[model samples]
Structure formats: structure tokens, C-alpha cells
Target chain A: MQMTWREIVTAVHGMLFGGFFLMACFGVLVLLHRSLAAHGGSEVKEHGRRRERIFLILMVLLGWAAVLSGAYVVYPWYRAAVPPGVTNLEMYPQRLLMSDPHTAGWHTLGMEWKEHVAWMAPMLMTMVAWVMMKYEDGSEEHRRLRAMVGGFALAAFLAGGVAAEFGAWINKKAPVTGGRVITLSQDGK
Target chain B: MSSPREAVANGAAGAAVLAASLGCFALGVLAVAGDGWKAVAGLLTFYRPTGPLSGVSTVAILVWLATWFTGNRLWRGKTVALGKVSVAAFVLLALGLLLTFPPFEDLLLGK
Candidate 1:
């Protein structure tokens, strides 16, 4: 297997960090919902509260990593300026997409929305994690708090889902290619 | 089966929810502003490599954190009207989601 630094970073951003974060969002959302029940999942709560807290912390971290990598590392390469007289725009993913009327919408709609909207997840999730950490005991059944947390979490999920979907499609149409190639394995024949 | 009158104050949690929604709303507003106006776009280009995204996200995060800090401080021990706060939050969150869509942004900008 072989891949460029850009491709690898992009995969790590969209696949690893983003993928795990999405799963974690679902997990935390379920946990929050389950707690809204009568017992607060006390059996699970006893052992799982700490586990849930740790998961939440990790989720927030992954959310940050995904967006930061997407914006700072991969996006710079994706949007790199194509020098004049450069006939081939392969290295410039944004320009490559823009050059074609058919593919321009990917850049305009997919990328534009993803870049901004993806950010909301981490911000909201961080707050969700914080509130859960401080106030998530099973004692009071804080229904109002639980409902709001669930709402915020669901919003974050939708935002991440949008970003991930667009990112996958945009990359499929006009992949962010180039950078130093790394050989994963030589011909083992 | 907790008490009819709960113990913990809802203030801190309420602050967090409110601030997060406000931050989201700010991001939407800033993103639209950046897209609609050349001057705003240039000003928001904090990092050349990342374009305007760098500033938009950074400023929105700052708004979130600052509002969170202020809200936390002001409403730490006391209870808040979370019912009202939650309604506002959902509205803002929905608006944020909508504003990020390019078609919606363009419609509002008359593009």
C-alpha cells in the first residue's frame, strides 16, 4: 500500500478522528438518554459514570483533532494556490474542482459548508462534556438539563454527519492529492 | 426516584448550554459575513493557508469560552430559568445549522 502525506493526514482527520468522534457522539447521546429513565441506569451508572466521563473527554479531544487537522493540515493543501501557467491542477484540489463546471458545486457547496459547520460539534460537545462531568449525578433526575444536553448532542451529531458526508463526497470527486509518497510495503512477491 | 425539589442549581449547566448555542450562532453569522463581503473575508483570513476559516472558528470559540466564563461566574450558585434558556438555545442552534448551508447563505446575501 502507498499514500502521500496529504492523503494520509486527510484519512486520519476524516476517518480516524472524525469516525471515532462520531461513534462517541452516538455513545454519549445514548448514555444521556438512558439516564433520563427512572433509575439513571444505576447499575451502569455505578461503574459507567467514570467510564462515560473518560469517553466524553476523549470525544471532545477527538472532535478538536478532527477539525484542527482538517483545517490546518489538510485544508491548506486542498486549497493551495495553483501557480500561473500550471496546466495541471492535480495538486490543487480546490482549483481542480472549480475548473470543471460539473465539479464546482463540490467545492462551493460541500467544502464551504463543511469547513464552517464542522466546527460547531467540538464547541457544543465540549460544553456537553463539561456539564455532564459536573452535573451528571443520578440523584436529582435533572430532566431539563438532560433534555438540553440531548438536544445539543443531537445537533452536534447532525453537524458532524454533514461535514463527514460532504467531505467524503468531495474527496471522491476531487481528492486532495500530492505530497511525499510513502511506500507502505514493497512488492512482496 | 429523586426528591420532588432537586438539590443542584441549574445555573452552571444553563450557562454552558446558552453559551454553546450563542457560539454556534456567532459562527454562522461570521461565516455568512465572510462569504458575502470581500472586506470581511480578507479580515477573517487569519491564516493564509486555512483562509477565512482560521479566524471564523477561532473567534467563535473565543465567543463561546468568554460567554461561558462570564455566565458561569454570574450564575454559578444561583438557579437559572433554563426553560426559557433552552428554547432560545434550540432556536439559535437551528439558525446556526441553517446559516452554514451555502444556498441559505446565498439567499440571504442575495447572491
Candidate 2:
């Protein structure tokens, strides 16, 4: 019935990646729609239209992938713990509590996943923006688009990397151990 | 009436600005890869530990400023499309940082 911290961490990792993937997919969709409207025209070249369509499809697929992966990561825990009679919404509070800071494994997992989502979402969004700008028709608009997307992407990449590193440092300095099963404090002192 | 020499000088100035902006953009990319300071500051408002986050933020801000200045110079007096895009990008970056940091955390949390 009990799960190891490693297993929990792995699940959190999956969730984080999944969340980012989903966020990216959404960003891409937004970019695609905007690009299609802004750049599409009667004079649209065949190449431009083709590229636009490809981006649109790609964003949709990535979004779905993130949703599926995210569900896969968290759903198992939900299914195993929740009783058949109880609905997910009904069991949500307990599940959330179980995942709180006091429970080391759950806490670590939650924190890790949150960090992952934070990093991934912005990074992916930046990438989507970059790609949209890249494929834009070589107009004044295109140049502006590139600068906007590139600037944001650059910012996100910098910010996310720093946050992740900081989180890692904290984890190392104050390692969390679940329950009272193991304690290293007594030996050192 | 502007002479041919003046036109050439103006063209050269524009070229120099573009080149400088491009360089800054490249530097920003490198900083992001290496976990630069601005990146750190942007993310520190979240659950990040204090030390490294501050360091990275310091560096990232410097780089961002350098890039912005270069970009502005390159765009000259005109509101070129590229200039607008660059402004938008900077705004988004600031927004993202805000969302991740303290005051904006509530917004990100759907609170």
C-alpha cells in the first residue's frame, strides 16, 4: 500500500513534463491561430500556407500529447487510492492533503512537479513563439514578430533555468525524509 | 538636401545598430543556457532557494538591459516592425517573471 519516495518523484517528474508539453501545445495553438489570421491573404504563397497548416497541426498534436501524458502520470495514483464508490472531486481534498509537505515523499513529488511545470510551460511557449516568428512572411510584421518571440523565449529560458537550479540546491541542503522511519539527525549531533 | 556621403553614413549607422542587437541576442541565449542571473531572479519568486537564484537574476537583468539598449539603438527613431516585436517580447518576459514571482504568484495560482 505504501509507495517509495523514488516512485513518487518519478510520478512527479512525469507530471511536470506532461504539464509543460501541454502548456507548449496551447501556446502553439494560439500562435498558429494568430499567424493564420495575420499572415493569411489572397496573395499568400503556396509555401507559406503549407508551413502555416503544418504548424497548426503540430500544435494541436503536442497539446493532446501533454494532456494524455499528464493524465497517465497522476491518474494511477488517483485510481489506486480512491474507492470505487467515491467520485474524484469528493476524494480531492484527502488526496491533496496526502501530498502535502509533512509527508516527505508526497511533498517532494508535489514540489518537483510544480517546478517542472513552471520551467517547462514558459520554455515551450517561448519555442512556439519563436517558431511562429521564424515562419512568418518576410515582412515588417515578420521582423517584429521575431523580435517579440525571441525576446520572451530568451527571458523564459534564463528564468526557468535559475529557478530549477535553486530548487535543486535547496533539496540538497535540506533533504526531506518521510515519516519517522529514518532519522540522521541523532548520529551527527 | 542630403548628400550621398550622408546617406552612406546613415546606412552604416543602421548596420552597426543591427549588428550590436544581434550580438546581444546571442549573449542572452548563452546566458539562459548557462543559468544566468536574470533567469534566476525571474524564477526566484517561486519556490526557489535564495542563493543561486539571486546570482542568476543579477546577471540576467544586466544582459537583458544590454540587449534592450542595443535593440533600441538599432531601430533608430522609427517604430519599425522589428522594434515593436522586440518590445512585445520584453513585455512578455517581464510578465512571465512577474507571474512566477511573489506578487503575481496569486494570479498564476488562479487565486
Candidate 3:
């Protein structure tokens, strides 16, 4: 069976979101473990470091997937269908791309963030992971680096969630129909 | 026993792993952002369509290989400190991520 362009976009977008959501959640868990370790003593902290390392690896791989998938969807697939003289910014206006008109202010703000900030989670987390790898488990410096990376992961999670919502919204709002220019509301309402 | 010079050379190779890893990650960001010159230069994929992703992935894979090769020799069992340079580099990278985001752009430009 032949899948429609919309289906393809949707599937890829889903992968991007799923990967990011899992990574972000994992980042949070790592952070929580680290915080508890600060007070939980040496043995507990050692366990936290090991877990954090695994989570960091996972986050980096997920990040790679998210970035690559996002690029594939936007650059080659969606843009190919975009008409001449139309930029993504123009096709999907920032107001709509950033936020939903039907949503409350905070929800809109939250959505807006994904377009701008969500990509940073993996980059920052990877740096933290690399830094942590150099130091042995349960070291003071390792904990500090873990906390920092965890904080970035949380930031990424919020942005990634927003991005996933936007992807879903766009899939419905503007699908690629054959030989026709699709026009969607600037606000996606 | 290895000479002191050989030991220093190995340490440098090990350090290169961190640099390569960070470089690959940064290249990935450049791919997403499509920052003109860097994106084009980094485009290893050669296919015009999927250039950004291709370039980013190519660079990332190459860097990871280098890191893996050097992993066994890095730090010589001593503690690794990121030091001021590494810290500053990370901060700059984080700021780049934030600044390039649409919301951050709007926030900064009074949009």
C-alpha cells in the first residue's frame, strides 16, 4: 500500500516527538536521582552516577534522531512542496507556528517555545555527558556536571513538547495535496 | 616504557576526542539552523535536498569514530576537569541555542 505524503510526514514527526519526550523525561529522572544523592550518601550517589551515564547516552542518541528527523521533514519533504517565494516563516506564520489561537496565554507561550528553544536539550546534555565521562563516578565534579546537564534537559523537554504539538497542528492545518496550493490560517485556528 | 614525548602525544590524541565530540554536536546545530556558510561547508551529504542532515550525520559519525578510538587512552586514569575554556565554550553554545530560537529572537527583538 502506498502511504500519502501526509502519512509520511506524520510518521516522521511522531518519531521526532517520541524520541525527544522520552529523552526529556529521562533527563528529569536523572536530575531527581542526583538531587537525592546529594543527601542520600555515597552508596546511593554511586548508583545515581551510573544511571545518569546511561541516561545521558540515551539523551544524546535521541537528540541525534530528533535533529536528523526534523531536518528530513522540513528541508527536503515539506519545503519541496512549498511554492516559490514562500518561506516556512511565511507558509506557517510565527504566530501560528509559535502558538495556538484557541489556547490560553500560557499554553500559547508554551507552544511558541518549541519552535525556538527545544533543540538545545541534546546539545547541552551531550556536553555534560562528555564532561562527566572524564571524571569517575561519585565525584563532586561529576555531580555538578550532571546537575547542569539535567537542567538543560528539562529546558529541552519543554521545547520538544511544544515542537511535537506544533508538528501535529501543522500536519492537520496544512497537508500536501497534489497540484494544489494549500493555504492554512496564520494562527492555525 | 614509553618516552615522555610519546605519553604527551597520546594525551593530546585523547583530548582530541572531546573536541571532536563537541564539534560534531555543534555541526548538528548548524545543520538545523542552516546558518548559510557553515551549513553549506558542513554539508557532507552532497545531495542537495537532504544536505543539512547528511552533513550533520556525516560529521557526527566521523567524530564519534575518533572519540571511540581515543577513549582508552584519555586522562590516564586521572580526574578530568573541563577547565575554564571548556566551560566558556559550553556557555557560548547554550547561548547560541537560545538566541537562535524563534521565541528568543522575538523576545530580544521586541516582537
Interface RMSD, one decimal, each candidate: 1.3, 13.5, 7.3
Where model 1 places Cα greater than 4 Å from the true spot, the runs are A38-47, A141-143, B1-7
Model 3 off-target regions past 4 Å? A1-5, A15-37, A40-59, A73-75, A81-120, A127-136, A139-141, A155-169, A176-189, B1-45, B51-53, B56-86, B102-111
DockQ score for candidate 3 = 0.17
In order, how many clashes per candidate?
Answer: 0, 9, 1
- The residue-by-residue lDDT of candidate 3 on A29-144, one tens digit each, is 56546553765364445676687678667767776566556656553544353456654433433333344555333223443344334444444445445645544345454455
Ranking by DockQ: 1, 3, 2
DockQ of 1: 0.77
Worst 10 residues of 3 chain A by lDDT: A176-185
Residue pairs with backbone atoms closer than 3 Å in model 2 (clashes) = A148-B85, A158-B39, A159-B39, B37-B56, B37-B57, B37-B60, B38-B56, B38-B60, B41-B57
Deviation (Å) of B52 in candidate 2: 31
Alpha carbon lDDT at A2, candidate 2: 50
How would you encode candidate 2's per-residue C-alpha lDDT over B1-111 as one tens digit per residue? 123322112222222223333333433333233233455445443322332223333443355446545644654443333443445445444544443343234334353
Candidate 2 deviant stretches above 4 angstroms: A1-56, A68-135, A153-189, B1-111
lDDT of 3 at A88: 49
Question: What are the TM-scores, per candidate, against the unseen true structure?
Answer: 0.95, 0.32, 0.53
Model 3 lDDT on a 0 to 1 scale: 0.49
- Order of quality (lDDT): 1, 3, 2
